[model samples]
Target: MKLDVELPNPQNLTEEFEWTFPVGTVNENGDAVITSTDKSPAKVKFKDVIGSQRVTLKTKLGGRTLQESVFNVQVAYNKEVKTVYFAAKGGNIMAVKVDKNKTPEMTIKPYDMGVKSGQHPFNIFFNDSSLYVLDCGRQFTYINDETTQNMGDGKISVISYDGKKVETMLTNVGGYAFYDPFYGYLNAAEKKLYFSDRVSGFAAISLDARNQTMSRSNFPYFVQSNRLGYYGKTMMYTSLNSAFEFVDGTWWWAKINSPTGVFRFTNADILSKEATAADPEPAAGVVFKNLVIKSFVVDVNAALVHVVENSSNALYSVPLDDTILKAIAKVDDIKTYKIADLPIKAEGTSAEPVSITQLILDKETGYVYFGLCSDDETLYKSGLYQYDPVTKTLTPIVEGMGVYGVAINNAKSKLF
Candidate 1:
C-alpha cells in the first residue's frame, strides 16, 4: 500500500522527507523507502504489512527537521481516553489532554470553535463529550443604552470537545447587571442547568429546549406574587448567592440577604406548579446572620459542605444532617463550624488579605482549590491555591492571574 503525504510549506521551500516504519517492516538497508514526486508531495510505499501498523513522516526544511509537523499514520487503532475543558473570565474556552506526569497538553483554542473574544465564560460544566459554557457576555455598563443595558444578555452554550461545533441552548438571559453568572450546576439526570444571577435570581433551564429565555419568574424564590407583578407567582429565589448539588441529587443554595443561610430545594419543588409565595421556601439551615457567602462546594464523601465568606476570607463547614440537608430548619437548628482560614497574604509579606472568589473540591485527591484576588490599590495578591483539609495546610499553586474558577476531572486526575 502507498500513502501520499503533503507537508504544509507556507514559504514554498524545498523539503526533504524521512519515513519511519514499524519494527521488522524496513527494507534491507533498515530504512523506509520514501519518494518525492516533482519536489512536492512525498509518497511512502508499504510492502507485505499484515495487521495494524504505524508510520511516521518527518520533514526537513533548510537541513533542520520540523519537530511539530511530524505526521503519523495509523492503520486502525487510534483513540483518545480523556479530555479536560476549562474557561476563563474573559470568554476563553481551552481544552487539554490529560497527562499524568506533567502539565496538561492544551489541544484547542477559542478561535477554533468560532467563539469571539470578550464573551466572559464564567463557569463550565463538562459531561462525556461536550462542555456547557455560561457566557455572561461583557460586563453591563449601565449606560441606559440598549446595548449597554443588555450587555449581560448571557446564554448557555455547548461546545464539542474537539472544538468543531458550538450550539446555544439558551440565550438573552439576564444576570450581568452586577457580575458574571456566579454559579452553575448541570443536572445531567434531569437535563437541566441551574445557575445563579446576582441581579436577577436563581433560575433553571431545560437543556432539552433551544434558545429558551429565563425570566425572573422562572427562578426559585421565597418572595410573593404581589411583588413579582405580571410575571405571575413562580418559585424564584433572587437572593441566591451560590449553589451546589447535594449528595442525594437535590440542591443547596446560599442567600445573600435576610434569612442569610443555605437553603435546599429538590427537583420536585422546582417543577411544581405553585404560586411564588405559596411555593415551598427552600429548606433553610446553617444560617450566617451577617456574613455573605461567596461560594461553596459539597464534599459528598465527607458529608460536609465547605463555605467561603466573601468579606473575611473565613472558611466554614457544616454537617449534612437532617437539620441542614434533608428538611427545612431554623437558623439555630444548625451550627456553623469554623475551618482553617485561607492564606491571603503574600509569601513573605504582611499584605492585605486577598478575597476568595471561588472554590472546588477534588473528592479523589482530597484537595480543595480556591481562587484569590485583592482589592487594595497598593497591593495586588491574586493566584490559585490548594488547601489540604487533613493537614489544614494551604499551598500556593501559581500567582498573578486572577483565577475565578477551577474544575477537576477526577477520573483522569486532571485539574483546571
Candidate 2:
C-alpha cells in the first residue's frame, strides 16, 4: 500500500518532501532503511512493515524540511509489538512476545538481532525504542588467563528498536561477566554508562554522542582501585558482579568474590585524587555488608532493592536507603520471594557451566522479572518469570530455554 500526502497549502509547488516513520514502517532492503524523498504526493509504498505506525511527512525547501511540517498517520497490524528480548547462545538476540490477551511466543532458529562473534550479549537496555547491549566478548572464554589476547575484547552495541540496525559503540571492552549480566549498570540521570572492565577498575561511558569513539585511552575511570579515595586499593583489578548508581548520584558496587557487602563511594571523594597503586580511599565504605548480591535492581518507588543472593540462591528485598542500610538492619527481616527456590547454576558447567542471569524491574507495573536455569518443573518453571512484588504473585513467561540475557522494553526514563 502506498501512503500519499498532498501539500496542504502548496505554497511551493516544486518543493520536495521528506518522509519519517517508525523503524519498521519504512524499511527498504534488509535493515538499513530510513528517510526518503522519492515520490510526488509524499508517497510511501509500504513493504513488510505493518503496524499502527506513526508516519510524519515534512515538506522541504532548499533541501531542508519546511518550517514546522509534521503529519500523523497510523497503520494497524495483526499482533501487538514484542516486549522481551534476550541473547541466547551464538550471539543472536531473540524476541519473546508477551501480549495481554495472547500466549507468550518466542522466535525460533534465526534470531531477530545479530551481534559479532565471540560476544556474550549479557545485558540489554531499551530506551526510546533502541537497545544498548553489553557484549562481554571473550571475557569468559579466557577467564583466569592474564595473558589471553582477547580477554578484553568485550563490546557495547546499539540496535534499532525493530532489531534492524546493529552498531558497536566500543570494543576491547572487559567486564566481570561470570554467569550473570550484572557486570555493569546504566545511569539515566547522568546519561552515562558505568561498567567494570579489565583495563580499568570501573569505567564510565558518556552517551552524549550518537556514536562514541572511546578507546582504552578515553577511559572514564569511575572508581579505580588505585584512585586516592577508592576503597579496594589492594586489588589490581575488579570483577564486579552487581553495580548501580542511585538517582542521588551515589555509586554502589559488589565484586564477584565479595560476600561481605555492597561497597559505596561518591564521585567527588574518589575522582579528585590521582590514580596510583595500593592506595585506599579514605571515604570508601560498605553500605550493607554480609549479603552476597549476585544480581540486583532498584525499585525507586518502593524504596527497595531486590537482589538475588549468591549464597542462598534466593530473592530478597532490602531497604534502598543507604542511611538505614548502614544502621545495621538484619538481612533476615526483609521479605524474600519464592522464585529463587530452584538450583540456578551461576557457575561454569562440568566442562562449561550455564549462567543463570537476569533480574530486571518493569517499573510501570511494579513487577520484577528474572530468569532461572534448571532441569526441573514447577508453577514457576525454569526459563524467565515475572513477579509482582505487591501481591507476591509469580507468573512464568518463557520456559524451557537457557536464558542468557533478559531486557524488558519498559524503560520509562529514556535517555535517547
Candidate 3:
C-alpha cells in the first residue's frame, strides 16, 4: 500500500500536505476535529485541517473483523522483530508478532496489575525472565511472579529477574518531589534508577547488584531533567534550561538552547564548589572543566537525539565522535513533523491532561515511541508508540496508558 508521508515545516511552525492512497484505504483525516465535550464522534469539523495526520491502510495483519484488530499498537520500531509487547487500553499485555513481511499476529496476556485509571500502561520493564509492569497510581506488579507491592513515599520499584519471579527492589529517592510534572518519568538505567521530585532536583539511586539494595545520591543543583541515557561511567540528562552529565568524579552542566536540539557539553569549567558554574570568575582563580560529553541518546540504538524548543518540533542530530566529547556537525533532516498534527486521540475526543510530549527508543528494537495520552489530543492521559524508521511511519501499538514516565528495558526475547 502507498502511504503519504507529510513532513512538518520548521519555520512556519505549521505544515500541511495532501496525498491520495489506493482505493478502499482510509487515513486519519485532519479535517474532522472534535472535543471531549462533544456529543457524537461522527460530527465535528475544523476549517483548515491540513491533511490527515496519520497514515491508514487496509491490512489483514491481525484483524478479526473489519473494525476489530488483534494488534493494538503502542509503539513502532525501525528494526524488525519477531515479537513486540504493548500495554493495552483494556488492562492487558499484547504481544504482536509478524512474519518477514510485517503481517501481524497476536496473543494477549490478561493479567491485571490493578490499573483502573489513565490512558497508557503504568510502565513495562523487560528483563531476562519476565515483564515487570508498574500500573501507574495503582500497584507495582509483575506477570511471572504474581506479586504486587505498594510504592512507598520517596521510593520507586525496580524489578530484577532470577529465572523465576521478578524481584521487586525499592530505591530511596523521593517520587512526588522528583516528578512533579509527570509521574511516569521514573526509569532504570546503567544500574542506576533516575527520577525527579516535584519540588526538588534530580536524584539517582544506585542499584547494588550484589545485595540488591538501592543507594541514593542527590544531584547537587540540577532539577527536573529528562533522562538521556548512560555512557561509560556517567549518566546523561536534559532539563528545560540546561543539560547535565553526572559522574562520580564531578557534576557537569551546559546551557540548553532548545528541547529537541542534540547537545554535547564540555564541562570545561565545572566546579563542585561553585553554586552556579556559570557565575563570574572566582576571586581565587578558575575552575577546571570536569566532564566532556559527546552524544545524548534520544534513541540509543538509532543514535537519534534532539533538544526541542517550544512546541516547534524542529528535530536535530548532533553527530559526535566515539567519546561524545565533540560534535562533528549538527544535521537537520529535510523532513519535519508537528507534534500537534499527530493522530493521538481516540476517534472522537478533546485534548486532555494525557498528551504525548517525549519520545523514547527501545534499544533492543531500534523503535522510536512517544509518551501519549489515553486520547491522542490529551497530554495528561499518557500512552506509548513505536515508530518505524524504514517506512517513515507511526503506529499506535498501545493505548489507555497514563502520563509521562520513564520506560527503559532491554531484553533478549519476549517471555511468552
Candidate 4:
C-alpha cells in the first residue's frame, strides 16, 4: 500500500507537517510517537491518528514491537541461507531463522566472542563466514593472546563465525589513536581490509584470513562523516560535504572553496585544482563551513547527492555536479533539478517524536526506516517506519514500545 508522506521544510525541520492518513477502518497521524511497557511482549500506543489501517503493515505475517536501548543497532543476513542476524543491547548477537511460513522475529543468544563488552554494535558485517565488528570505544582496550587489566586501548575486533573467536587488529592507523565509529570495508575480491574514521583521517589494514595479521598503511584525506560505499573496483570517499572516487589506482577529488586535490600515490606529484585551475567558489559551498552539522545520510544509489543538516538548522545536499566545479573542469555539470524534498520544519518537537531520529535507508529498495519517540528519555516508544521514495509513501512496518534500532533483511524475509 502507498502512503503519502510530506517532507519537513528544508529550512525548518522541527516544525511538524500537518499531514494525516486514513485506512479501511482506522485513522492515523503521520507524526511519530513512543510508548512505555511493563511486559516482555511490550505494549505500544499509536496515539492521535485518524485511521488504523493507515498505520498497518503490508507484509503477510509477523508483528512489530519497540526496541528498548540507547545505542545504535545493526542487522546482517546471508541471503542464500534465508537467515537474519542482529546485535541487541547488552552485547548479544542473535540469529533468527526465516522460512516461508514463520513470522519475522528473532531470539537472542550470546556469540561469546565479542572483542570487548560494551562496544557499540553500531557496525556489523558478514563476509565469508566471518563477522567484522567495529567496537568504537572512547579509549583503547587490550586485545592480544592474553587478557590484560589495562582498560583503555581502543581496537577493532575481528571474529570468526566458525569458532566464534576474536583477535584485535591495527592498534594505530596513520599515527593517530583509534576511536569509535569506524567505517570498515573488506574487499571480497582483493582480500583487503580498509579502515577510516568517520570524524577524521583514512587508512587501510590488510588482513590475512588464514592467520588474521593486520598491516597498516597511511592513506590521505580527512573524512568528516560516516556515510561511504564501495562498488566495482572503485571506493568512494565523502569529504566534508562532497564526494570523490578512487578508481584505477588514481585519486580524483573535486569540490568548491577547497583545492581540487588529486594524487596517484605511485607518482609524487599532488595536483590541486585550485592551484592550476581557477575554480570559482560556488554559492552553495562544498563544505558546511562553520555550521554545526547535526545529522547526515547518503542515498546509496545517489552518489552525487547526500542528505545533511548544518548548525544553521538547514538541510541541504552537496551536489558534486555543482555549476562552479563543472565550470572549472570545462565540462557540463550533470546535476539535475531536485525532484523531491523532505518535509521537516522547525526544531525541538513536543516530546521528541520518532520523527526526530534520522531515517535509516535500505540500499536495495531505497526505503528509509526510523522509530518514533514520545520524549528523549522514552526512546523505544514506537515501532518501525518504512518510507518508499517511489510512491512518496511511509509505512509503519512494526509498532510497539520505543525501539532502540531498526534492521530489515528483506532478502531473507526478516526484520530486527
Q: Each candidate: what lDDT?
A: 0.50, 0.55, 0.33, 0.34
By TM-score, the better pick of 1 and 2 is 2
lDDT of 1 by residue, 1-416 (tens): 45455667798777777656554344444465543323333334334332224456676876777873333332211223234344533434543333223323322111112343235454667765666777655542222334543445667777765556788776654533533344577777878777765534455777656655544544444322123221132213334355455447565655554334455555444432333544344443243444556577878788766777654556767675555544324333233466655544332111211135457777775667665543431443455556777776666554444445555444442212
Q: Compared with the true structure, what per-residue lDDT tens digits does model 3 show for residues 1-416?
A: 12233333355443322222212222246343222211112322222211112222222212221222121112233334344434554443434432234323322211222222233333444444344433333222111221322232233443333212333444322332223221222233455434333222345544433222222343333332222221111222322222233432333333222222222332343334423323443221211112111112344345544322222222223222233423222222212421233433432122111223344456565656554444334533345455565455556544455433333345432323
TM-score of each: 0.57, 0.64, 0.43, 0.42
Question: Which is the winner by lDDT between candidate 3 and candidate 4?
Answer: 4
Task: Report residue 234 deviation for candidate 3 (angstroms).
Answer: 23
lDDT of 4 by residue, 1-416 (tens): 22333333455423222222221112234334232121121222233211112222221112323232231122222223233333433434433333323234422111122233334333444556555555444432213312432333335555565325766654432223333324444455666655544333345455653333222333343332221121111112223212233433433322211222121121122223222223222223333222222233446375433322222222334444435332322111212322223333333322111122233445665655543333332323344344555664555444333322223344443222
Q: Using TM-score as the measure, which candidate wins?
A: 2
Clashes by residue pair, model 1: 219-235, 219-236, 220-235, 220-236, 220-237, 221-235, 221-236, 221-237
As a whole number from 0 to 100, the lDDT of residue 317 in candidate 4 is: 42
What is the descending TM-score order? 2, 1, 3, 4
The best-first sequence of candidates by lDDT reads 2, 1, 4, 3
TM-score of 1: 0.57
Q: Candidate 2: what lDDT?
A: 0.55
Candidate 1 Cα deviation (angstroms), residue 370: 3.5
Tens digits of per-residue lDDT, candidate 2, 1-416, equal: 36565556545546677766555443333443367676443334444333224556677665666765554333333454446666654535655544444433321112344443235665666666666777666444326644443335567777776666877666553423332122567666667767665323667776544455444467656666555344444223433444454445566665444234566667665655665555454455664466556567778888877776665657766667667666533356343433345566555522233344556787776777776765456534556677777776667766665566677776321111
Q: Whole-model lDDT, candidate 4?
A: 0.34
